[model samples]
Target chain A: MTEQGTTSTALRESITAGLRQAVKRRFGAAADIDAVEFTSLGGSNRTVLFDLVDGTARRRLVFRQETIIPANSPFLDPARQFRVLSLLYPEGLPLPEPIFEFDDEDSLARAYVVAFVEGETVPRRLLDAPRYERARQRFCAQAGEFLGRLHALDPAPAAFLAEVPDSIDPLATTMARIDRWGGVHPALELAARWLERHRPTSTRRCLLHGDFRTGNMLLDEEGMRAVLDWECAHLGAPAEDLGWLCLRSFRFGHVDRPVGGFGPREPFYAAYASASGHPVDPEEVRWWEIFGFIRWAHYNVMQAYGHQTGARRSAAFAACGRNIALIEYELLMTLAGHYH
Target chain B: MTQDAPSIDELLVTVREFVQEITPQLDGRDRYHAQCAVYLLDIVRRELGADGTDATAEQAMLARYLGDGAAGAAGLAALAAEIRSGRLDARSDELLADLTRQVVGKVRITRPDQLHPMHRESRPAE
Candidate 1:
């Protein structure tokens, strides 16, 4: 993690300050905002849980606001993110309840408000190391099931299509993004090019949890409470989720394990297939896997620059920039018929 | 060294070292590319461990499949371009399979087991 000072308390004060203004603006005069606690900080924004706890008042509620600009800055679009998520998931998927969101940049620079979801997202406990091992498979299965539910969502074209920009092919947009970073490593040129050639197209489109992985989902002792981070959410083929979950990079260290080092590909695919009633498509899986590798390499390049500029510095980010080479090698092998 | 050779992990270490030293002095995006070089090393290393093969065997497999001439076919980039162009399909499936086995052995590192053991997942299982 970047050594950005945890001015989180101070930031919490700032958010409380902001929320007090919001409450006064909306409720005018008698807004009894009780408390705000700084709960989480991540690569994108500062999150503070604002509690309007008037226990007897039927409106006991909490919301999240993106306050601080964490290192590389988060890709979340507070407005589009909440709107599309609400449309696609519609309370079916485990996700945040968006009471209100603002994209007017001026509101808080890079700010958003979401319902405070109380859960632990430190997946290592749920995957590898103990104390949570008994809950591992079930937890992993729940994460998969949530994503399965996500992939199973039909945004009904009109609402979903309206949210994403009119000018971009979701898959192509993703490929273009990967390509934008293609200039990074010569080692990856071949893989990047290979990914370009093999990019998959899925007409059976659905709302894709573009960044679905262990850390992206929020979990608790019971299981996944919510799948957070809709920053990269998009409309695409379901296989993208499959490929992303299985990508080796997400495995962290247990390279032997797929699905973010949580479990095997079959069970994940089985869970998704069962949810969607669509059997897994390995070709599509390969296509999406290639895309996943492409995405990984691209992001590594992006983060490498982040490390260099000293915007963010971490073993993983540094390791991430270095990780693209491995992604490249995988790409070349894939192109050379490695997985064929 | 045994016939298995330096191992992918060892090779990766070399690449990582290269990344550390070579990353500087390059300006603009090339600096980013350097990061990828480092990452590729890790990927190769992982695959080497996963596949239990060395560069020599991989090279030999490629050359044999290409009928003693494949490695020189304009580097990996050109080879990839050729593959994309479908020009390389001129080679027989046996030769193709040999080249494929080499590549497959490496890339399949991410998979948990030998479902097909030779081919990419054509479609998900029943």
Candidate 2:
């Protein structure tokens, strides 16, 4: 066999053996794994889907493992993410059920298993697919309701999340990342100054799905199935999540539908207000939306830096460097009140 | 110095077409990377086609605010520092307009289609 082919085969064998060990330990010795498929979904994590068969019963599960973590990455480590999932799974949130976390005995380090939720997570498909038309109609209300419930969850149990820089001060955290990445972006600096000056006064801190947006959600024709990607979960202002969902970049060409390219802001805010019994503050949300743009730009810059420095070479990352221009344009337009 | 028959722009177009032609055969991650490649090629083409006028104008605009010797990457860093320090707060309106023009120039190269209709129309004709 060719050297590359031989190496891949050996790698696959090791993964299968590691998973077999995990399955046997969790589901008894009789249980075995079948059809392990690697999913290229997350940028900074490796996700594998597989079927664990115990006698006649078969269960589909996801094996999510941490990949190369960039220095000063904003995302939580796998252990912390799993902890967050375990803490929130019983809170009636629409999230995947956490199974078992990988231990030292398992060959796979920094990984965990969860019950696989079936739904589409791609933003393009969720936004444009004809099959998702009904889902799109119901998405805003569902998102608002979900966010309301998520934000209202008791923050005491997730106290560990407070260590996240975003939980302390999201704007400052993003600016720090930008600076570390050698981002000399004047547009982002301008946005940061604006954010600092017009900072929201509300001190209501709650558990936030720090990367709350359309792409991170799993949806079907009925509506949202589960909220995935908990790596960014933190304790922060509820409006932060609300604004993140309304980011212009997340609108995906459906600029008219301000809320995740699904519907207008009023219905979403109304749903949240109805659910949480807290009146939606448009001004605060607007501040967060501007902050969201800066945060998004920082992420892009970080990815581009990774590509440039050879930490993780990817065409997608290279594209991110160029995409910053579009993001900057939109951010400036939003700041100038030229875009709604 | 004379260049080859296939200019940089021509080569970019040919490679982009090749990527598109092979894109159908690829799936999943490869296809996504191919799409990104096409996007990067387009950006490069637009950047190459652009005259140096926008960049020169941007430098001049920055010099107006930061005085002479403020140009290029150093000028941008200085502008950002000034903005961060609130030294440019009084001139925010003018600064925002100039920054918008600069970002608009960038967007024109990277993804002009994303620009608002007003901004698109305001872009100087090539």
Using TM-score as the measure, the top candidate is 2
Off-target runs (Cα >4 Å) in candidate 1 are A1-12, A24-35, A55-76, A103-110, A139-144, A157-175, A178-187, A196-202, A307-319, A330-340, B1-126
DockQ for every prediction shown:
0.06, 0.66
Candidate 2 structure quality by residue, lDDT tens digits, A160-248: 98878988888998998889998578998988998999999999989898888988989988999999999999998999999999999
RMSD list, candidates in order: 9.8, 2.3
Prediction 1 global C-alpha lDDT: 0.58
User: Clashing pairs in model 2?
Assistant: none
TM-score per candidate, chains pooled:
0.65, 0.96
Best by lDDT: 2
Query: lDDT, candidate 1, residue B96?
Result: 40
lDDT for each residue of candidate 1 in A4-104, tens digit (9 for 90 to 100): 33444565566677676666555556665675555434554556565653334424345544443434332545556666666755646778766655445
